[model samples]
Target: MPELKLLLKHKARTLDEYRRIGGYAAFQKALAMDRQAVIDEIKKSGLRGRGGAGFPTWIKWNGIPKQKTKRHYVLCNADEGEPGTFKDKELMESTPHQVIEGMMIAGWATQADVGYIYIRAEFMDCARAVKSAIDEAYAEGLLGKNIQGTGWDFDLHVHLGAGSYECGEESAMMSSLMGERGMPRLKAPHAPLPTIAGLWDSPTLINNVETFACAPHIIQNGGDWYAAMGASTKNSRGTKIFSVSGHVNKPGNYEIEFGTKLSDLLELAGGIKGGALKACIPGGSSVPILNAESVAKAVIGYEEIGEVGSMVGSGGCIFFNEHTCIVALMWRTAKFYMRESCGKCTPCREGTDWLFQIHDRIIKGGGRPEDINLLKQICAQIDGRSFCGLGDAAAWPIVAALKVFPHEYEYFIQHGKSIVDTPQSKLMFPYAEPVPV
Candidate 1:
């Protein structure tokens, strides 16, 4: 498989080391080009936000208003709080300089005079690394005040958020950075969108760690170099670093081009840990779960994952062996959402709690026949009705669990719990061997 680890090359820490590997040459190239040309280059790359939403990177930057009187901000969303996801944390700690360079490129392209990295407080190492890189950049005239006599001044800062998952959202992140509660804002019409009114109601452009990190490379190696790497399908593009975990024998980060099979990815991760692969969460905790049958058909791009009725969220693939209990797995997943819900909306705040409680009851041998039906009902209200993506994201996997493995819920409802004690225990969605199709 062709791998594109633009920001993963080792020994590229200090400015000199980074320059040796052709580091900020792209920025110099970018500086020479017109601002619109830089934006066009990024747009041509077909790079989407690696932060789950998969939004086009250039469109977000292009949306920044060209008003000199109003402040424009370019932010790097490093608050990687998704369960079963940790790629951004590693990127920040390892290739801090790459991230800084990417941010600088974005700042220049968007005409943003100021930039900030809103990293979670839990990522103290990431903070240190980014802050250290920022200082190094300032000393070398790579950041702050004037840059290489371009007369474009860009100041960068690192703001530590209080480790709230809600703050991972762009709106919530802006709120947390402003020293306010980390809750999602009420999204309104596009007359004054985030590009025009964000982070103190100014034109702001935000991109996740991986998304920004791609900028320097895309600029260095032309848009065609990146657009040619990933799936042939229209949406998912470029190589993605998936944080593989759960039940996999060799769970770790693996960068592969899009359109790879889920089963092939499992082989890359050394297959199932101790038993047959029963199911897998193709994306992070937020996306829907893929059944054993569907997993066989599932591919490794956003469009393909969507075709399987799941999302390529954060590229966090979590495997589950046949021995794993579906109800218990979902119960734990629901509990995470329940605890992490920002309580900003009535449906999400209350609905996540209800989902967790129901899953708990089903797993604890206290489920009623109507429990699964009721769960489906609660998920309906929470799926699209929530204020932010959190509530909608939390409801997706639960709904997927119901669809792909109805027997798991039925078994829990009948037996009051999942008991894989005998061969008879393997009822529906059996994957004793999980052979690739």
Candidate 2:
């Protein structure tokens, strides 16, 4: 109903303040219990991955081999590269210890010998905050050998990537972490699951920053306690932090419980700014765009959002006002994906460029009559044909825009101008440099 600040409960800046606000209490409670019990608590909590894919968190934790024959490693994906998403960055910056404690709990649950936080290079402030928190953790015997005298040991490290969006993918992050190119590897069925063979061919557990940040909470409050929060949704449980941006008046991160209305999130961000809401990308740039009609009925759960023809992807909710031009917005989005494509596979490498070319021409008033169908055809070809999700990510928004705003493309192509014929809409592409006389 309102902002549920489970993870963002306190803006605790230091380890001392964090402890005063009951920060590592969950990790301490976890230490006294069996590792299976720790994971079982997560299982009962019904917490899903806070990353784009809402996979069940406990399954990944439990997937690690119980025998522990080889070294186990835990990985935190701090590379927040999704456009319109900044929740993970805020989590790392504001409550660094919360994230560290969560990872430590994961290390204990999975019998991990070491853990690494793969942060983006641009997040230097977040890196320094987390690094300082880690230093504080070691000084207090909360980390390193014989942690808290439980005879269990875990070493945590921070790694910064060279700011590649492709590395945000789990396998790609692992590749970059191992000093390889920032490209994706063959996933399950073709290769072993990351849990079975990741980061130097050993058992590894990888979860994003927000997913790990939820661990401490789940461990502290019993599983049942966490599960009850989002009972209104079919399966989505607990709270999710959404990074609201674009036309919202007070754009920032707002944590809301599952089953909250999508419109409610907009209101929490202080409503639309320049004009009335026209459309919204309920997730990150990669998810389908929802028209205002759909947004009104959309609920903030994984399945609920899907029912409205979008996904709760990465919790990057971007609202577009009435003055916005859907075609121009999509053109910019296409350009981003095209530039960020890793070029690892033929479908994505070649297909993304094609998509950007089409959008570029259309937005520049050179669109052919068949350009709309061509865009759809290209999206179909690249949706699932590529090596990884990047292809799908590149294709989804284009496909959604075409479906949701068909008239925009049709009118823009037919008249060589946006149908939203407003002075504000003309200003949308202000970056177009003046032609020299």
Candidate 3:
């Protein structure tokens, strides 16, 4: 198989071009079949959400009740805000019809009348591309009332978010689409599911961009055919989009069969740039960090990544070669969560700030080993104690980094500088003149 799959050679940015490539064929097939069969096909495809959670797509669509609702909605989460993750943006910008086709089919399955593509504020070009695609779909009668004359009155629109990472959360995205502050809502009775109640109290089916993008293909090909493309694991199967960033020579999105080893991906990415690999954030910044050696055996999927105490979250593999200070990297990561904290819960809001402060001290070369222990304690307290996943997400990397690089951290504390970044008996950063303590 080639390095890239879905978006490669996919020049179907518009409805006409997309149709030429069998764009609406899946949706048409979906309309002709029983809704349950379509859902079953998705299940057999083994497609999971590409937006971090990796939740089974078929199960999520099945969560919607079959009963009639006044209004049902399909929302595409295009908020690609995770640090070092951009697979969705590439898919959306390049293969807009894939998403459109997927959403149309999902709407048909759940009887949704409206669909919205909620893109992040930072993806201005992607937003424009998606909006234009929507326009083209509407113009050619592929969208809007009675799509392809199948009596499926689905209307699609693009709604751009205001740059809040919290909006990446499903409920929060729903809130934002309904004109709220973009903070997550308590998941109880849920966001009034798309089959029963969603936007304006209607049943809503919200799926990530990549998750939807995979749908048309799954529907077009038999589910087993799609599932056979990747790892044998039932937990997380099929191809995934991994965004390699940081010290890699080729840092971009690469679609690989699930369970492809991290080492192979690094090699495919042209290896670490200018230095030996030190550590890697296997998933997005929210996931745990793996030391270089651990990542050596790690694979690019949920199961293998979990074996090494990390996740393939959103498939963002950020490499940090030698000379990259783990303490400094963590401090930078902590600061991102701190600034992005929505302050919805006390633990996340207060704990993130505290974690940032401690990491800040350690990175500046003025903290004790107790600070390391304290950071772990704070992360443990924050996990599973906050209102949303953001709190837990912020702490996973902190704890993972400590577990993998304790010695480096201890060296930093005792010498008042990173082992790689500072030189001296104990008082000088390598990049600057000696400092008197």
Candidate 4:
């Protein structure tokens, strides 16, 4: 494996060690140029948000209002709630300076005076590490006021999220930061385009944790350097952190360039632990599932996966080998979304429970043939129609599982029990785990 350590390496949390590696050089470089020039550089670099949306960073920055405002905020979203997506926590805990430096450069580009790192409550350790790095930057005057004596003052604070997946949505994050419940806001008001109204009526730019971490490298090496690291897809550029889990032997994070084969990523994880490669969840549990043959051909970038009927959402590669029962897997995966559903919209709130019911009936050996079609139709209705991605998120595994393993589902309906004919079902469901009736 060609291990080019840009985001994962570096033990230094202090400004001095970060400086030794040409860290803040980007911030310093950005300070010398006009804001639009910096934005142009990011556009040229082909940098997209690493938090799964893959939106162009330059477009987001440029979307901010240029008119004079009393306050503007640059918020780094550290709420890594996607299942199997721990890459952000790794970057934050291991090489925090990169994230801080990147955010400061972002703040400089956007003319934001204040920045906040809204971290998940579960990631307390990463929060501590990042907060410590922030303190070190402040000591070196890298964070607070008149940065590098350029008369550009930017201050950063770390805020803790109450730990909801919906908070990962940028608008919900803003509302939560304002001491409101962590529910996603409608897009029409649209975060006011991050230029007009953000974080208490100021221009605010909120980016995922890893998105900001990639900035210093782009700034230091020039946009071309970062752009050339991955596939020539319009949006997928630079390295991606794949947090491999499930049946994989080496279930940990693997930092590889974009466009790396899904099979190669699984090999990096030492392949599936015991069973034959049955299925894979290329993104988090949110994106659709890919069968074994398709997994072998799947590439690691955003546009690459889009061609294969799935998305590269959050880079959480979950492997499920032969011994895994699809009905049982769907049951558990649906249960996660049902539990984590913010209960906001009708489709997500009600449909999540409906999915749970269908999967529960199937896994318990009471499925009907028509239930398969029902699952697909229900998921289709939920995928694009819900309030946010969570509806789609809850629907993905169900539809994907049905698409790839229709026969396995059929066998369950025919037998009126698990095809495996094992006693493990009882162990899998200890008690009647209640889903909405």
Candidate 5:
């Protein structure tokens, strides 16, 4: 509850209501200042993208090629398809205008002509909510043609994407927006950066929904004001909203300043649901899982989470209690990425399927003696060689889980069953009869 600056109040839905609650003031403040001044304020506030990468927002905007003749674009990535990550969906549903306002400020900063909030097709609620807000903003003279009499014209639209995890990557998002299949492109140094050449070869400022939602706050509160909230850790400033799930009694979004203890947040979510906490996934299903001890010691900041060999990916924390099988969890994780692979890259398209097969076999009491080594080999091939973050994210958790709980994998191999088999997995199993694990 750390005085949420992003989540809107109960009645803060309409343009008038949001304005009453001090909503669009930030965009107005940004409009009054020099365009560069808005970016400068964000740079000064030390605001990093809340989109899991934690990239500095100003740096991304500053990187956009500033050409007067060329049209620039601001793209808001609302395709929140990452497993266990729902903050963006909830944020948009609660306050679509906030995200839109953030986009307006970004448009002004980057001198963009148009913007799109690419929401996932599965998020029908979020899509409808954002679309309604956009229409309302347009009707109220807040978007499209001379917003608030600032003599600046910016148009925003909602582009619904066929929910694809790979599309969550900015480059893939641009491709999908262009009516192309969602897949990643190789980002080489020789090629122009996306900021310079994006969205049909124009400058595009791509940021996540949560990142844009913070723009107004940064502009209104001053960069230093937002920067001073969390621990002064490198790349870890201001507040973040974490979507906590799995084995938590009160699973939901919890907004807190950085450097808050992970254990404290778990407690805020009412601790483990049915049993003692066994492990935690600090970021999302994509990042590495932390042992119970490491979970206890971990803090809320990105850098601190990284120090524990896990990333604060999209700020989605999924905790599991002792009854949960660590290996089974990894199996589920691998299965998800395998099914979601965009099939553009050779490694990810093939390697992810291979991983799922191995996990499936391992959980079914058919694990080979060399399975661990094989998992290591496949993970190495997929981690650094894939075209985008999706492949790397897919392999990260499995690799980390194997390293942290090698015994769990070994137990299934030796005992011919999952270590923590329960009724749910038993009923869901597609393999041989159960045995001691």
Candidate 6:
């Protein structure tokens, strides 16, 4: 109902302050209990991956081999590359120890001997904060050989990525970490899941920064206690931190319970600024765009958000005002995906370029009547045919924008201009010359 501050409860800048606020208590409690018991607690908490997938957290933890013949690894996806998403960056900068402790808990649960936080190269501040926290943990005997005298040895390291959005995908990240090009590898059924073989062909468990940050809270309190907070939503438990930006007075991370209404979350961010709310990209740029009507009734849950034709993807909620042009917005989004396409697969490599080219021409007042259907055809070709999710991510928002704002695309194509005539639209495409209808 309100802003639930479980993970962001404090700016735990130092290990001492973090401990004073009961930070590593969960790792300590996990050490005393059976490893299976730790996983069972996570299962009971009903926690899903705070990453875009929303996969159950415990399933990945349990999937690691029980035999432990091979070296096990715990990976924290600190490369927050999704557009409009800054929650992970905040968590790492403010509560670095919480992230480390969560990874330690996962390491213990899965018997992992080593852990690595794959951070983005641009987030030097976050890398330094987490590095400081790791140094503190080692100094206090909380990490390294014989951690806390429990005879369970775990070492953690920080790795900075070279700023590739494709590397945010799990397999690509694995490839990059192993000194290979940051391209995606073949995934499961055809090959092994990351749990079976990852990061130098060993068992690896990976979760994003926000997902791990929740672990300390889930383990410190009982699982049921965490689950009860978001019981109103079907299968979605606990609070999710949303990075609210664009046309909002307070553009920052606001942690809200799962069942909170979309409008309520908007209100929490001080509502829309500049003009009346026109549409919202409820979850990062990759998810579908929601019209004002859909946004009015949307609920903030994994499945509930899906009901309104969008996913709670990485919790990057961007609200746009009436002055914003949907076509122009989508043109910028397509350009991003096109530049970020890794070119390993034909569909994403070619399709993203085509999508951007179409949007670019349409915005520049050279659109054709058949361009809308052509765009749809390209999206269908790319949606499920690519090697990784980047193709789908590239196609989803374009398809959604076409569906939610058909008139915008139709008008832009038919009249060679945006229907929403505003100063913002002119500012968005300053070089465009209007074609006489």
lDDT of candidates 1 onward, in order: 0.85, 0.92, 0.82, 0.83, 0.85, 0.93
Error of 5 at 230 (Å): 0.9
Tell me model 4's lDDT, rounded to 2 decimals: 0.83
lDDT by residue (tens digit), candidate 2, 28-54: 899999999999999999999988999
TM-score of each: 0.94, 0.98, 0.93, 0.94, 0.95, 0.98
CA RMSD for every model?
5.2, 2.0, 3.8, 2.1, 3.0, 2.7
Q: Cα lDDT for residue 327, model 5?
A: 80
lDDT (Cα, 0-100) at 8 in candidate 4: 80
Q: What residue pairs are clashing in model 1?
A: none
Candidate 3 local lDDT, 127-147, one digit each (tens): 999999888878888788877
Candidate 5 residue-wise lDDT, 17-85, digit = tens:
778878888888888899888988999888888888898889999998666668899999999887888
TM-score (C-alpha) between model 2 and the true structure: 0.98
lDDT tens digits, residues 189-214, model 1? 73367887898998889899989988
Candidate 6 Cα outliers beyond 4 Å, as residue runs: 430-437
Query: Cα deviation in Å at residue 256, candidate 4?
Result: 1.1
lDDT of 6 by residue, 351-394 (tens): 99999889989988899999999999999999999999999999
RMSD of model 3 against the true structure: 3.8
Lowest-sum lDDT 10-residue window in model 1: 428-437
Best by lDDT: 6
Which runs of model 2 end up more than 4 angstroms from their true locations?
430-437
State candidate 1's TM-score.
0.94
Candidate 5 positional error at 84, Å: 0.4
